[model samples]
Target: MPAGLVALALGGFGIGLTEFVIAGLLPQVSRGLAVSEVAAGWLISGYALTVAVGAIAVTAATARLPRKPVLVGLVVLFVIGNLLSAVAPNYPVMLLGRVVAALCHGTFFGLGSLVARRLVPPERASRAVAVMFAGLTVSNVLGVPFGALVGERWGWRATFWAITGIGVIAAAAIATLVPYWAGEVPAGGRAGKVPAGDRTDSLRAQVSAFRSTQVWLTLAATALGYGGMFGAFSYLAYTFTEVTGFSSTDVAWLLVVYGAGLVAGNMAGGRGADHNRDLTLIVSLAGLTATLIAFGLLASSPAASVVLVFLTGVFGFASVPGMITRVTDHAHGVPLAAGANVSASNIGNALGAWLGGLAISAGLGYTAPLYVGAGIVLLGLAVMTYAAVRQAHARETHSSPNSARSPDRKASM
Candidate 1:
């Protein structure tokens, strides 16, 4: 592995830590800020929404720019955002800090994926991307827990400061260590030239990727699929404590086990995606839904809860790289749009959480969110499956004799 990929992973670590550490300290933050616990939850929604929006817009605007500057700029925004959150005397200002940090979140990952693909050979691309994403999986395993401790021992603001410093270090890692790879066309792309009046590679090359039907479906699938998981997960700490009757401290350890599952799933997804992107996606999506349902039903039992939560993590995160790879595989040369897909994932987070919250607020039980999550992921499977079938039929139809004889007709599947 090259040093640049390591730097990119470090950047991902900082981003992931900044994104999730707030959940661990929400109670402290709410008490200190004198806000309702519900109100404090906005920090999560606010950051996620901002990141989702920023991911699409920023990646598009900066799509043509050099990777190094963009990566550095994102970390700067991240550091500044955390610093502001650290010192905010008011909840509003703290949210503003989160939004600021979120603006850079999607763009960084999007660009980082592109960078990862370019850094190594084609066969190694999936693993390269996985290495960078290890930072994300590891954050769940390490960063969130450590941040929670920092907030507990020192102060919540101190935790943000620590994260801010980590952002700085990540920035340094990218700037000094990572090689400056100018964003270019991927290798083995746009090849075999406009075959017999066909333009597979050139189809709507300049059109807005967000506007494509397939892209829209893919994004919707992502938003719903992930929203389902995070919705229940956001409340896992609550469920394990009150429902399963575990000690407060034990929930933390349970989360560690969940994080371990995320790491395992992430690696599995990475390798699986390389062999069969679509198959990996289908399997992971279906597994995620099943696991959430299993977790919701069995979580009342302590031993069962532990087993289900870990399984949920494994099945849930196993989709990450495959989700991304599928989108980019279709996208080919359109790397920015690929990044926008990352934004789509976060959007799913916000939607799933909000929808899940509605079920809980309506006097539905805690397990409602898990069922809701399972439903969202199932919806993604349906959409992706439709796309898969459509692509297959289209391929078959285009290969037919009459269609091939028509000179002006473009091939589509």
Candidate 2:
């Protein structure tokens, strides 16, 4: 409800638009730049790769800096990138613009989540994250379509010009609304325990948090769980039009339905995670696995495909809040964990898209990607179950009396 949260969401909206709108405008961009279609596609892949690297490297570099200023600077960088894209006369220049914009992408989400959590009580931390991410979902539902429309009416450069305007607005809002103290600590943080003059925000300190086995497990779970759904989603247009017999135009509307589901699932997932983080993640992954398999079986039926695609969005995104929460929780206040989690998610994105493409090129049917996706999600479920069991065992070991007593010295004591 805070104006600051709205500003953060606006920033998210702008960044999300930059990331996805290109997919719809790829053809226009390719022709404009006089490049091969495959080369234009690198804009997306290169941006993604930059985001993954920047998520960790940039976040670590700025771990010791004030978060508000970092966010504001990142938005300024975003604006510059869009301006370059709007005026780019060659393919290489456009590629440079995308790379510039991407360097700030993951760090924004990572730092934004931390700031969002700081704005509220621990009980509502995940919900705050959900609110910020809502902007991302809305961008998919509205922004991508609008960008495509603008490109069709004018030129691809015109769309980037509009996005540049968005970046300006987001930067202004963030600079005006977000408080400096939002970067200091959460409501229940170690503020008093650490001296103001002797604060520890070094990269080495942040990296030490990875010493926890639970953190590694959570990262793996994020990569696998998120990858599973994206594998199917990457080829959704083909499945809907070719496999389900929907018209090309109908595929666009169906994507809107899936986007709507994403919005709903994001909100619901946040609330559920607030109550029980681990259980929410497990259920979401399990549900996604089932939904994908069912989708594969019913791909030929238009009605079933429509219903199942929406369900896939719901189950797929429902794990997100829990995933972010789990990573930060296990990190025990480490600054880089949130950024690392962002990197992990992007890694999953690349993996899913590649794996799904492989299934299609192997001469399997369009529905085959969905089956492969289901199997990947099943692997995620197995990993999560193991994490849960390990957690339970650690708790049991800590609670046992023998854990506290020295056997050689104290039989009675």
Q: What would the TM-scores of all predictions be?
A: 0.88, 0.93
Please state the error at residue 385 of candidate 1 in Å.
1.8
Minimum summed lDDT over a 10-residue window in model 2 is located at 404-413
RMSD of 1: 3.6
lDDT of 2 by residue, 248-338 (tens): 8898789888888888888888989999888888999999999999999999999998899899989888888778877777665556888
Itemize residue pairs with steric clashes in candidate 1.
223-348, 228-373, 394-413
Best by TM-score: 2
lDDT of each: 0.79, 0.85
Candidate 2 TM-score, C-alpha based: 0.93
- What is the number of backbone collisions in each predicted candidate, taken in the order shown? 3, 0
